[model samples]
Target: MIGNGCWFEFDEVRGKIIIDGPMTTDLSFAAEEMQKYVRRAHGMFLPIQRGVLSESTQNAIVVRIMAERLATVEEDGFAITYRNGNVFIEGNGIRSVLYGTYRFLELYAGMRWLTPDHEVIYEPTDRKVWIEERHDRPDFRRRGIILEGVQSASYAIGVIDWMSKNGCDLLMMTIEFWDEHQAALRPEMQARQLRLGLGGHSLDRFLSPGDYFEVHPEWFAWYEGGRVAAQPCFSNQEGIAFLIGRIVDYCRQEPDMDTLSLFPNDNKYFCQCPSCSTQSFVSNYTTFLETVRDQLEADGQSVRIQMLAYNAQIEWTMLESMPEAASLDVMVACWGRDYRQTIGSPAGDRDERFRRIVADWGQACSQRYHSSLSVYEYYADYWMMTSLFPPLARTICKDIEEYRSMGVQEMICLLLPYEKSVRIMQEEIMGLPRENNLADREFNSETPVMWLNLYMFARKLWNSSLDEAGLIDEYCRAAFGQHGDTGKTLLYALEQQLAQLTVYNTRWFKLRYTDVWIRDHRSKGKAVVTGVSPWAKEEDEPEIPAERSEVSRRIVEELEDVWHKAAHQGAHSDESTLLYQALTQYFRYVIQKLRSIDKQSSAQSKLIRQETEEAMSDLTEALQIETEIRGWDALHFAHRLRDPNVL
Candidate 1:
């Protein structure tokens, strides 16, 4: 019996189906949209019926309409059933329904839902969790990569779109001014301009309290006895109103937006203005939220607001005075320092750190606000070359468990820009088995693990307690298609190497006299040999006292060993592409250490510069060699050589 709240009921005898509801406008069209799925699943057309909106219709259905809040402002309305059935699914809107339908068909084809007796045993792990959905659809899923390396809305949308296919529910954009193009939101730029306001790069362009020196300068919050550039001048009513209006306008117009993330809350310390510096951190956010609320309300539309628990502002006292309105129709997107648990291991305990941070943040924020809180785990470390898979997965799992423990309900991954990482996450998400079983095998694939990782990462936004191993197996099969064993071997080795590297990667180094001397005196102030070669000479030299720099020597030596090990791992790997990239970086670091020791001779500097150039030339050749060997473009290496020293 499909007992009822909101149900997608089908009648084979009548050759018809009815989509019942308390559904959003998008979900209300589900019955009309079922044909796509029906065609895919049963390969036939069916008439459909939709129930009228009423208490009678709402109270007695097998499935119930529910809201799964997303990180974005968009509302993801869904259907849930406490009763068992032949099949169950959840989708974003039409697209999601189509996708869910396809998933249903895939499972059907595999007889994944049928039992030995040919009876359907279709029960969700929890009756309340039959289907979970996304809050919004990405406007332009793929933003072609930008050369300047600035993370753009277009770029993020591309990531969102890719992740969406794998099961990600929501995506965030850190919007600003520069994104609008050289022109304002004129009709010409409208076609090209992203939905969210552009992300501003220069700090001066951002509306900081200190930056508001010329016009409306009186609004600055010169509170508490200190002065700083970090806080925005919320006290400046005119300036505040102008910024708030812009944000509200952006939300109203941008079709891709489901939520508008207010980046101002990232302010670490409160403003030092004599009038308001002492205000609670949360109060600062609430002030902005209230100002935004006023503007949004006036615009005659409600938008979900997402605020950050960023920087030094992340404290319990801040949450105390958060405005009531901000709490309503709002969600928490917490990011500060890093998710400690995201970096798991003996040396780096990302899991333990996550537990502590999540508990503290969750309890503090939820106690004061009536909002859904999601933990954005930082999985990838871009400063160094590494895949965020292990730490990403490990941190995600820990967050799932901890958030569940804290009675908070959502988990989101703060991904860096990497197609490979996204792919791996997808597998992890879909590979999650039918129920929550941590002991189940991790999702792995023979091909590339990027998709699997993306899938799993997205799945966390839905139900965290799903099957672990089965999902992994499913994703592995999908990613590898045929070379299952090969995929598994590659994935295993990669995981092992990453696990080993995580230890050395997180080992922080304190600057030694040698490091300082190397950067300032030797090698023409270039830490890398490549950075130093441009200024090399055969006559002049800079002097440095060697014995006084024991700290610098030790630091250099330790870092050198770490790089050497990484280099060794790369050589050991059969993947020539990954191997050479790692080796290249390791060699650069090694050359830097060597150059650091010779701070005084033009002749020695010239030799070092010459060697560095040769090494760099070798790296370029290696990249080309690997590209030829693979008979393909060297995608990873293309960016590395853009700057052999700095970038």
Candidate 2:
């Protein structure tokens, strides 16, 4: 029953759907999305009419598009309602309508998109929806995730459209064959999206000796020896003008871009000339932005310029004055942070410096000028490359809240390269039998920690005041099943246990994880990688000691006990359960490594080897289950778990 107290049923019993506006490709896509869900609900697909509806048409879904001038809901916001016995989905624009369609299914039909393909849609026995009018918008304007490079995985998975439906409005990058693959996107995604350039550090590339340094060396930044094009001399009037011209030309080429990054070469080569020494870097940067702002305004363009205020370049002295037109947004980088503790907390911890730097930077961006602020976080690293889920929920959540408080409106959470964060572990030579229905969910088991964090990240973006325990509970229930509580207990326990490690003391947990990964890689000759979306690239491995094996031995025994006592273990083999066991197996190998180092007796070695083999067998089964569910291993690679250079 709707708010009007009338039952709303979308079955073959309803009238044909009608497009109430220009029947563009996006509208067609929206209609198709609605049609599929309708069929799933009633076992009958609804026919859609693009032409004028019949005079007598009744009880139909009408997708409406507002005029271009009146699109105040930004790009992706929408409104859904039931009126005059017909369902209506209206948007500020076509893309908004498409988002509305997805929202309808989510709120009224009990549909949850756990993954792009994996979903859980509850079938209503009565097939009746009680939808009060709902209008929704995002908390922030720039909501996005960078795929970095998985051109093949991106195409195969329909990642863009999935993002559109799931509240992502921006997709970054293009040099990686972007246009070539864009043809595969559905019409809705094509209509409502923006692609950002991460390679904004292009000043040197454009102002190089090969391009202009030879003609005018003064335009280039100076090192101890001489002028070079590696970085521009910010104080040089002519050079700033030249770089601005280059940026304008690039902007013309990519007119669809809304945010333009004016980042310089990613190095420490700033000008040391007498003129530069007289003033501050921030003041000089402000001058460059003022020039760009004035030029862009004259050109009648509203494109905004952003810069990376990174490292030594970010010293915070009082600005002489803010720019007349604060057209900049700084993307602050948080590097070498301690993942185990919140920024500024743990008083004497190394992260205190980071906390102070970010605080001062935030103030300068806000009080010092008209420029806005955003943050760039290394959400995933080398440690995250492994299957062990990093216990970073509390720390990251705290960061998000803190960033928001500091007036930062956007976050660019970058994960490392594909090899480290995109692949899963393989412990398979067998499959486990199940006795009941499984909790349905779609997740990248290979990147389980990141995958889990990805969802949490999205939630925090939408609502920063999150209940950590509640969020974990929902995630656990969705990713696992009846045993989710048990699994969550293990997850928290693991994170808490590892927090004690001096290894994870800093946000550089990635280095510590890599340390363990490479040491074990040599033990397992070659990894037989298969079963994933055909787009995933070949990916990377780690190990432990026999005296060390005692902890491993006990952990294996405990996990075994948990498995036996696990409620509804017959129902489904959960990811968390698999992850817990894999860690134990990896530790078992750790024990074996230590015993070998101690030169243990042959009899003792034999017993440890037997235990290792058993653990390996169990790991194989767990991995096989994971592969079956996630699917996308396009290449092969070694599992070398040793990298002395990483430490």
Candidate 3:
């Protein structure tokens, strides 16, 4: 390898790095052609010798580039050998520059790009497998967002940034408010801020509807609890038509609003007044759909309306009865399916509600009309992991797989509580192979080790056959920096924590639907009926006794101890400051309760309270110590590190 280096010479001519490797152009034209691919990969060229194929030369090049590399690739037709002082782009000719550019970007800071070399392994199976590549894309040209009052424009933009980073084709937003000044909550959403169309929901002022309701009492619907609710009654032809016309006008006026979604996916209750009661809810829904459709089509503009499958309209037959297919897009809203599993026997028929619904909708969409249908999956409940993630994923994957099999091309997840779960869904479960049935496997919850587990699952989404150990090695190096004793410790500890979290034996109940009521009943400090209260009973009435199980209490106490310890230890680590604060507040509240219970109970309660108080004090002190670690100059140092452009 060393002796072959002198056989070639390099020259920079006409903005190109040229190399004369040992092989003549006539003998290895393919190798020369391969250089084009290399240039495409690395974005630049670092020539390599045709004869010098030594491992050490390659390894040396690798180390040098790895020092401050942006991106990299390991394969033929695309090779950039970056050395201590220089870069070598290898290939037969100048056309390979594109490959070199790709390689340049594949490095960390420059542009950590995904490339063909990312495929670590490919086991050629003996069984015949039809390898038809299908690149699935989004149907809604603009994926829209509904920003309730709480989320600001900056927050919406941040979400958009994340969405764009992943694979959102387009971004749309709407402002929803509840009061007069509250409408100004979305003032940041100006024409300059939102590149896509913006929508406004003016229901904020329509809250008790004194004159509006009086003048148009026919527009209101009587809900289950004897409360009068409002629905734009299509039966009130003039008002309904005016509403539909305004919606169409809004769509036409808005820059990129090709789709108009009207129904509140989960919030809408049934309209039970006689005029609307006798009319098929589906028929009323169809009228609204048709009105919007006819107006848009007549204007030679395209728009689609989404109806929710919530409240009293869980029926798929609603879509079947609507004849004008060209008018609107039907979105079957799937929510609270996980909670449904707990209501009935988990064993009885496997809770096929979601799966069956998807199947039926897929059939209708295919066999019925020109307008398409998509799934609006809501992970609204924050405790999806503890309560729903496992089962929901299992059901969802099976259902989506079936839907895909049945030619349902588009699906969108309407997510809430967008924190780590987004990453979890993107990198783990959704990323895994369909055949792997990864949802079936309960993920290991060992903290740092679980990071490796997460990557393993994420790999499935991109490529099916990824090397688990190799990924762990890479991830460990990235997360902890070049694996050593510390890296091992961190990985091990993370794995343990993740495994601990996954066990679901903690004191916290999976809070979903009536589970919240169940928890409230159990924890109130005495025995009560277990499920939802009867219709006759007052909503706030404590029909159930407060009966916290001794076992559950112990579990909670242990978790509290862990949190307290974490808060204390956080003082020593820079990254743990936020966690420390959050945990400190949580532990203090819990610890206070631990003491309060002692006053009402026997000697055992006193002992538990004393121990818990000690833990809390320790944690509080630890937090104080963390505060001491910060200095006035902290902001200056942080500012320096914060701006990547400066550093």
Give the number of the best model, judged by TM-score. Answer: 2
User: Quick one: ranking by TM-score, best first?
Assistant: 2, 1, 3
lDDT of 2 by residue, 1-647 (tens): 12333456665765567788665534776788788876775567788878655656667887877544334355566766676667878886656787788778776666655545445553343466665776666565576665543436454245566566666565554333344454454233455543443344556544666768789999877777788666678888888788788766655665555665566555556677778766665566766766876787677777666666654322223212233334467777755554566664644544666676677667777786656677766564433333333546666677777777777777765544334233222212112233122212112232335545555666677567767778788766655555567657555544443333323313222132212222222223423212222101122210132332354345445544554555344323444444434333333332232222222212123323554444333334433433443311100101111221211
- RMSD (CA, Å), candidate 1 to true, equals 13.3
Compose the digit string of candidate 1's lDDT tens values, residues 276-299.
Answer: 545655566566776676778787
Local error of candidate 3 at residue 163 (angstroms): 1.0
TM-score between candidate 1 and the true structure: 0.53
For every model shown, what is its TM-score relative to the native structure? 0.53, 0.70, 0.48
Task: Judge candidate 2 against the unseen true structure and give its global Cα lDDT, from 0 to 1.
Answer: 0.53
Give all candidate RMSDs, comma-separated. 13.3, 10.2, 16.3
Task: Write down the lDDT of every candidate, Cα atoms only.
Answer: 0.39, 0.53, 0.36
* lDDT over C-alpha atoms for residue 397 of model 3: 29
Worst 10 residues of 2 by lDDT: 632-641
Alpha carbon lDDT at 185, candidate 3? 26
Error of 3 at 609 (Å): 21
Worst 10 residues of 1 by lDDT: 111-120
Best by lDDT: 2
